[model samples]
Each structure stands twice: as structure tokens, then as C-alpha cells.
Target: MTKLTLGVSSCLLGDEVRFNGGHKHHRWLTHTFGQYADFVPYCPEVAIGMGIPRNPIRLISTDTGTRAVDSMNLTDDYTERLQHYAESIVPQLDALDGYVVMQGSPSCGMERVKLYNKNMIPEKIAAGLYTGVLQRHAPAIPFEESGRLSDPNLVENFVQRVYVYHDWRTRQPWRTAKELIDFHARQKYLLMMHDYPTYKRLGQKLSNLKDIDNRGAFGQAYLVELMAALSNIPKRGHRVNVLQHVMGYFKNQLSEKEKASLIHSIEQYQASEVPFIVPVALLKHYIFLHGDQFPYLMNQTFLNPYPEELGLRNPI
Candidate 1:
């Protein structure tokens, strides 16, 4: 399989590109996810001609608007420079499947970047100028902060979206309705875990693809809905529900003892007594045993989204 291209902050990869000549290196990013990612690292400050060991910058709210300025010398505003650099860089990021940004940076933070008032008092928070521009340009690509990846659920969701988006992009220019339907069908359970109602709505929309005049338009519309539905982190309850739905396929095949064990494992997961892997393992065992009977369940992404070595769902 082709590695997914990802946009990452240079400092996260141990590059000494920060203002203080230090790096906020993340070991997991370099050693684990790095293996599957073709990381394209960038530092907005450096890209905008800021020198290493330079004065720190902050976002300041002015009568005109919010501006990024040197904290030491408020007169030195790099707002336009940063914004212009971000605009230029966004075009090149079209092929990236996702982005990983540094947290709490005036130039790169994705959310809650401090915004100061005219008196230099922080009054509110907003996204960093570069990330704000990136969001506007490529809202489809999943964006997450390095800090947030510590949460197992967030890590799982982010990686899942990245791989799925990469697959969708690589298999593009769908020439026939069957290709579109097959793609949608393969991702059915993955979508259900995120938002069941949106999943059903998307299914209905996809089912009517034949009636639409333009297949490209139909595909784009469905892609938008599909990504939107998978944006939210799937709750444990939602996942348990999906597992039960899978079990329904083998309702007549499984023996009474097998059903009891499967239900017990699922209930344990629902009650937070065990990690998500427990129930998933049992379900996969049954699916493998009855391989010829349940082709749909066998192809579900929920069974194994990312690599097992990542252990994204082991904790939750």
C-alpha cells in the first residue's frame, strides 16, 4: 500500500525551527505513525522568514483586526507575512491526506490561539493564522494537534480518517455507478460508528445515484456527506451497537454458547470494563469462522482500521 502523505509541523519532528531554537519533538509521531506517513514538515515562522532564536510572537486584537506581532516589539507585525505564506502553502497541500499542527502557537495553532486586546490583554482565543487559512482551503483533510493525539480515541479517529481519505483520493475519477456504490458499501460500518443518522441519510443519497445526471457531482456530494459523518469520534455505545448489528448477520449460525460469550464481551465493552479490542477480537473470530457466509462483515473497516502495532483501540 502507498504511504499517506501528511503535513506536520517541523518542530514536531525534532527540527530546531522554533523561535527559542528548541523543538517540541513527539516520539510516537517519529517512531510509529512516521512509518506509514510521508511527512511533509513545514514551519510557518521559518517559511515567513523568521529567524531561529527570534523574538516570540502573539496574536493581538486591534481596531482594524487581529494581528500577529512580535511580543517584545508590538510594532513588528508579521500578520500579513504569515497569512500570505499560509495562502501560498495551502495550494501545495492538496495531495496531503491530513495535517498535524503544533498546539498553542501564534502562527500554527489550530484552535484557541490567544487573542489580545489593544491594551495587550488577552481577551479571547482563535485559530492561528496559518491553520485558519489551511482550514478554509482544505476543510476535507483531517487536522489534529500533536497534544490531542495523546487521547487514544482521537488518535484512532484521526488515523482512520486519514487512511480512508487517502483511499478515496487515490481511487478517484470513478467512471461507473458500481464503483461509487462499492466504495460506499465498504465504508458503511465505519460511517455508522460516527453518526448513524447521517450514515442512513448518505446511504439514501447514494442509492439514488442512478437518477442524478452527473456522476461526478453525485460522487462529490456523497464524499462530502461521508467525511462529515465520520468527523465526530464514535462513542463506545455507538461501537457496541455496530458490533451487535454485525452479530445479527450470524444470528442463526452461532450456537447458544457462542452467542452468550459474544454478548458478554460486548456488554463488558459498553460498560467500560474492557478495552474496545476485546469485543472486536471475538467478533472477528466468529466472522473468520463463518467467512463464506458474511462477506459484508468480513470487509468492514471497523475490524481493523489501522495497523495492529499502532494499538489505537487497545486502551479504549
Candidate 2:
């Protein structure tokens, strides 16, 4: 597999670009995930001419809206500059499969950055100035905060989305109705695991592709919706449902003992007695044993969303 190209905050990559000239180097991102990805670092504040060891900035709720301004001198605003820097990098950012931003950054945080009112109290929460623009420009790209990556589920979800988006971007899989159908077919079970209602609705849209005149527009919209649906982490009940659905494919082939064992595994997962990987591993074992008879099940992306070596499912 080609290494995913990811945009990351320079600080997170150990660049001393912060206001205090410190780096927020993330070990897992640099040493672990980095093994499977190539990083493109960005420091919007530095790019916008804020020198290292400069005065810190923060989000301020202004009369116009939230603005990035000097923490000590609120009148010295950098909102426009940060936004412009982000816009200038649109072409570069378009090539990235995903992004990992520095948390609580005035220029790079993905979410929950502090927004202070005139009283200096954090009155609101908002995305960082730079990332906000980037997200608005390209909503489909998977963006995760370095802080949030500590959560196993969020890490898995982000990596899964990145791989899916990269596949769609690189493969350009929606050129024809048949290609679109095949792409969606591969994602069917994966979509069901994340959001069944969206799975059905998206399927309905593609049911009669003859009605669609603009394939490009339809494809873009479909991807945005699909990524949005996948952003919701699958609930335990949803996973159990998907697991059972996959299990149904081998109902007759499995012996009574095998069936009972699979049922017990699913029940254990549902009851929170084990991590999601336990049952999934067992299911994959069965698939390996009997997948030749059920080719469709063999092709489901839900079975192997991302590289297993990441150990993302272990914690989840």
C-alpha cells in the first residue's frame, strides 16, 4: 500500500514553531503512524509571519465574529492573515489524504479551541482559524486533532476515513455508473456498521443512476455524505448487527459448535467483555475458512478497514 500523504501541524512534528518556541511532538504520530504515512507539516502562524518566541495568540469573540488576535494586544489581529495562509495552501492541501492538527491552537486546532469574549472568559468553543478555512474548502478530507488521537476509536475512525478518501481520490471510482455501483458495493457492510440509515439512503440514490445528469456533482456530494456518515463511531449494537449479518452468510456451513462459538463471541463483544477485535478476529477466521463460498463477504471493507498492525481495534 502506498503511504498516505497527511498534513500535520509543524509543532506536532517537532518543529519549534510555537509562540514559546516549543514543539508538541506526538510520539505515536511521528513514530507509529508515521511508519505508514508521509507527513507535510504546516505552521500557519509562522507561515503568516509570526516568528517563533513571538507573542501568543488566541481566539477572541469580536463584533464581527471570532478572530485570532494577540493575547496581550487584542487589537493586533491575525485572523485574516491565518485564513489567507490557509487559503493559499489550498492547492497543497488538496493532495493530502488527512490532517492532524495541534490541539487548542489559535491557528491549527480542529475543534473546541477557546473563544474568549471581551471579559477574557472563554465564552465559546470553535475550530482554529487555519483549519476552519481548510475544512470549509475541503470537507471530505479527514481531519483529526493530535490530542484526540489518544482515543483508540477516534484514531481508528480517522485512519479508516483517510484510507477510504485516499482510495476514492486516487481511484476516481465514480466515472461511470457501473464503477460507482462497484465502489458502493465494497463499502456496503462498512457503511451499515457506521450508519445503516445513510447506507440505505445512499444506496437509493445510486439505485437509478440514469436519473443523474451530473456525475461529477453527484459523486462529490455522495462522498461528502458518506464521510459524514462514517464520522459517527459505530455503537456496540450496530457492530453486533453487522457481525450477525456477516455471520448469516455461513449459517448452513458452520457446524453447531462453530455457530455457538461465533454467537458467544458476538455476545461477549455486545456485553463489553472484550474489545471489538476479539469477535472480529474470530469472524475473520471463519471468513478465511469459508470465504470461497461467499465471495461478496470476502470483499466487504468492514472486515479490514485499515491495516491491522495499527492495533486500532485492540483498544476499541
Candidate 3:
């Protein structure tokens, strides 16, 4: 598979783009996730003609409106510059599959950047100005903060979405109805794991894709809904449901003892006694032993969403 293109904060990759002339330098992102991604790093503060070691900026709220202003000098507003840069670059990043942003930044934070009042007292939290525009322009793209990537569950979900997005992009301009249907079929289990109801709804929508007057519009709407459904991390209940469904494929081939072992593994996973990998590994083993009998299961992306080396679902 081709490497996914990702929009990332420059500092996350060890670039000295911060106002203090120091980089945030997240090692995991640079040395690990970096292997799978072609990163396009941006620093709105520096890109807007601001110098390194420049005066800091913050989101300011007042009777007029909230503005990105210098922390020490409220009059030095860069709101328009940041917004312009964000809007201009999004169109150029049409092939980007995902984005990773710095947390708590005034111009790039995904969420909960501090907003201050006219008196310069911190008030509430809001998204960074540049990120807000990016989200608005490309709402379907998967986005995560570098700080949140430390959580295994969040990292797993983010990586899954990125791979799914990249796969969908690689097979574009779906001229034939069969191509889209096959794509949806391949992603069925993954969608069900995230959100069963949306999966059913999207399935119904895709059924009528051939009848729709504008295939492009229909495909875009489907993409939006699909990505939104995947935004939620799959709960343990969802995983249990998917595992049981997958096990159904081996009902005839498994002996009584093998069936019992698989059932026990599933139960152990449901009870939180083992990580998700234990049951998933067992299922893959059975599928490997009897893959010819169940070709559908072998082709499902849910079995191996991302590279195993990432160890995303290790249950730890």
C-alpha cells in the first residue's frame, strides 16, 4: 500500500517553529508513525511572517469577537493571517488522509486551547484558529492531537481511520457500481465494529447508489457519514459482537474442543481478563487453518486494520 499523506504540526516532527525557538519533538510520532506517513508540516504562527522566538499569541474574546492576538500586546492580531493561510493550504492538501496537531496551541490545537477575556484572563476553551478552518474545509479527514496519541485506544482508532481513508482515496472516481459495492463490502466488518446502526444505514444507502442521479454527490455523502461513524471508538460490546459474528464462519469446521476454546477466549475478552488481541489472534489462527472454506473472512480488513507491529489492540 502507498504511504498515507498526513498534515502535522511542524514542531511534532522536531522542527523549531515555536515562538520560543524550541520544538515539541514527539519521539513516537517522529520515529514510529512517521514510517507510515508522508508528513506535510505547517506552523501558522511562523508561516505568517512571525519570527522565531516571537511574542506569544492567544485566543482573545471580547464584545467584538474572539481574535488570535499577541499575549503581551493585544493589538497585534494575526487572526486574518492565520485564517487565510489555513484556507489556502487546505485545497492544496486534497490527498491528505489525516492530520496530527499540537495540543494547547493558539493556532494549531485541535481542541481546548485557552480563550481569554478582554481583561486577558483565561475564560473558556476553544479550538485553535487554523485548525478550526481546516476541520471546516475537510470535515471527513481523520484528525488527532499528538498528546492524545499516547492513549492506546485513541491511537488505534486514529490509525484505523487513516488507513481506511487512504484505501478509499486510492480507488477514486468509482465509474462502475460494482467497484463501490465491493469497497463497501470490504469495510463492512470494520464499520460494524465502530457503529452497527450506521453500518446498516450506510449499507441501505449504498444499495441505491446506481439509481442516484449524481454518483459523485452520493459518494461524498456516504464518505461523510462513514467517517463520522468511525469517529467513535468501538466499545467492548461492539468488539464482542463482531468476534462472535466472525466465529460463526467456522461453525462447521471446528471440532467440539476447538469451538470450546474459541468461545472461552471470547468470553475472557468480554470479561476484560485478556486484551482484544488474545481473541483476535485465536480467530485469525482458526481462519488461517480453514481459510479456503471462508474466503470472505480472509478478505475482511477488520482482521488486520493496520500493521501488526504497531500493536494497537494489545489489550494493555
Candidate 4:
């Protein structure tokens, strides 16, 4: 696979572009995941002419909506400038599979940034001005805050979505009905694990290709819904359900003892006694040995969503 290209906050990449002339420097992004991806850093604050060591900005709730303004001097608003900068980069952002944003930043935070009211008190939480515009313009792209990557489940989910989106982007599957259906087939189990209802719904939608009037519109809408479904972190029960479904395929292949061991591993994972990777690894072993007999199971993305070397599923 080609290396993924990710849009990242400049500060998170160790660039001293912060208001305080410092950096948020995320080590895992720079060292580990960086091995599989090339970072395209953007510092909206700096991009909009806010020099290093400039006064910090914060989100303020105005009568119209949220505004980015100088924290100390709220009169100096930068909302329009930040929004314009994000808008101008729409073409550049299209090349990225995902984005890692700085949390609590007025310019780049993806979510839960403080939104202060007139009395200088934080009244609510919202996305930063820059990221808000970008998300609106391209809702299909996977966006995760740097702070949220600390959770193993979120990390795994984010990376999975990145790979799926990248594949779709590069392959342009929607060009033909067969190509689109084939792509969906590969993602069936992964989608089922995240959202079973959506999984079934999307399949039904794709069942009748002749009904699609505009392939481009249908494909874009399909991807948007698919990404939204994938955004839901699969509950342990949901994962167990998918695991059992996959195990069903090997009913005749595995001996009684082997089947019992696989069952035990799944049971341990379901009960939270072990990490999810343990059972998944066992299933992969069986799939490797018996893949020729069950080609469908071998192509499922749920079995290998991202590169195993990342070990993203270990903690969850």
C-alpha cells in the first residue's frame, strides 16, 4: 500500500508555531504512525498571519455564531481570516485521507473547544473556527483530535477509517457498479462490527445498481454515510457478534478442540478479560490455514483493517 497522507496541526508535529512560541509535539504521530504516513502540517493561526509569540485566540459565542478572537482583546477578531484560510485549502485537503487536529485550539481544534460568552465565561464547547469550516466543506474525511488518540480504540478506528477512505479515494470504485459492490463486499464485516443496521442498509442500497441515477451523487452519499457509521466505536458486544459470525464460517474446518479454544478466546474478549487482538489474531490464523475454502472471509477488512505492526488493538 502507498503511504497515507494526513493533514496535521503544525504544533503537533513539533513546529514552534503556537502563540507562546512552543509546540504540542505528539511523539507517536511524529515517530510511530509517521512511519506509515506523510504529514502535511497546517497551522491556521500562523497561516492567517498570526506571528509566533502572538496573543492566543479563543472561541467566543456571538449573537450570530462562534467567533475566533484574541483572548486578551476580544475586539481583534480572526474568525473570517481563519475561515478563509481553511476554505482556500480545500483542494489541498482533498489529498488527505485523515486529519489530526490540536485540541482546545481556537484555530484547529476538532471538538470540545471552549466557547466563551459575552461575560468572558466559557458557556459551551465547539469545534475551532478553522476545522469547523473544513469539516463542513468535506464531511467525509476522517478527523480526529490529537488528544483522543491516547485511547487505543479511537486510534484503531481512526486508522481503519483512514485506510478505507484512502482505498476508496485511490481506487475510484464508484466509476462502475461492479467496482462499488466489490469494495462494499470487502468492508461488510468491518461495517457490521461498527453499525449492523447501517451495514445492512448500505448493502440493500447497493443491491439495485440500476436505480442509481447519478453515480457520482450516489457514490458521494454512500461514502458519507459509510464514514459516519464507521465513526461509531464498536461496542464489545457488537465486535463479539461479528467475531461469532466469522467463526461460523469455520465450523466444518476446525476440530472440536480447536473450535473450543477459539470459543474460549472470544469469550475472554467478550468478558473483557483479554484485549480484542487476541481473538482476532486466532481467527486470522484459521483464515490463513483455510482461506482457500472460504474466500469471502479472507477478503473481509475486519480481519485486517490496518497494518498489524501498529498494534492499535492491543489495549482495547
Please identify which of the two predictions, 1 or 3, would achieve the higher TM-score against the true structure.
Answer: 3
Off by over 4 Å in 2: none
**For residues 1-316, could you state the per-residue lDDT of candidate 2 as single tens digits?**
5789999999999999989999999999999999989999999899888887999998988789989889889789998888888899988876889999999887888888988888889843899999999999999889999989998888999999998888787777466787877788889989999999999999999997863467788888999999999999998899999999999978788889988999999999898999889999999998999888888888888898888888888654
Ranking by lDDT: 4, 2, 3, 1
lDDT of 2 at 237: 92
**Poorest lDDT segment (10 consecutive residues) of candidate 3:** 208-217
List the candidate 4 regions with Cα displacement exceeding 4 Å: none
CA lDDT for candidate 1: 0.86
Model 3 lDDT tens row, 102-184: 99998999888899876677854888999999999888889999899998888988999999888888889888777888888
Q: In candidate 4, which residue pairs get closer than 3 Å at backbone N, Cα or C atoms, i.e. clash? A: none
As a whole number from 0 to 100, the lDDT of residue 280 in candidate 1 is 88
Best by lDDT: 4
- On TM-score, who's better, 1 or 4? 4
lDDT of each: 0.86, 0.89, 0.88, 0.90
User: After best superposition, candidate 2 residue 216: deviation in angstroms?
Assistant: 1.0
Q: Which residue runs of candidate 3 sit more than 4 Å off their true CA positions?
A: none
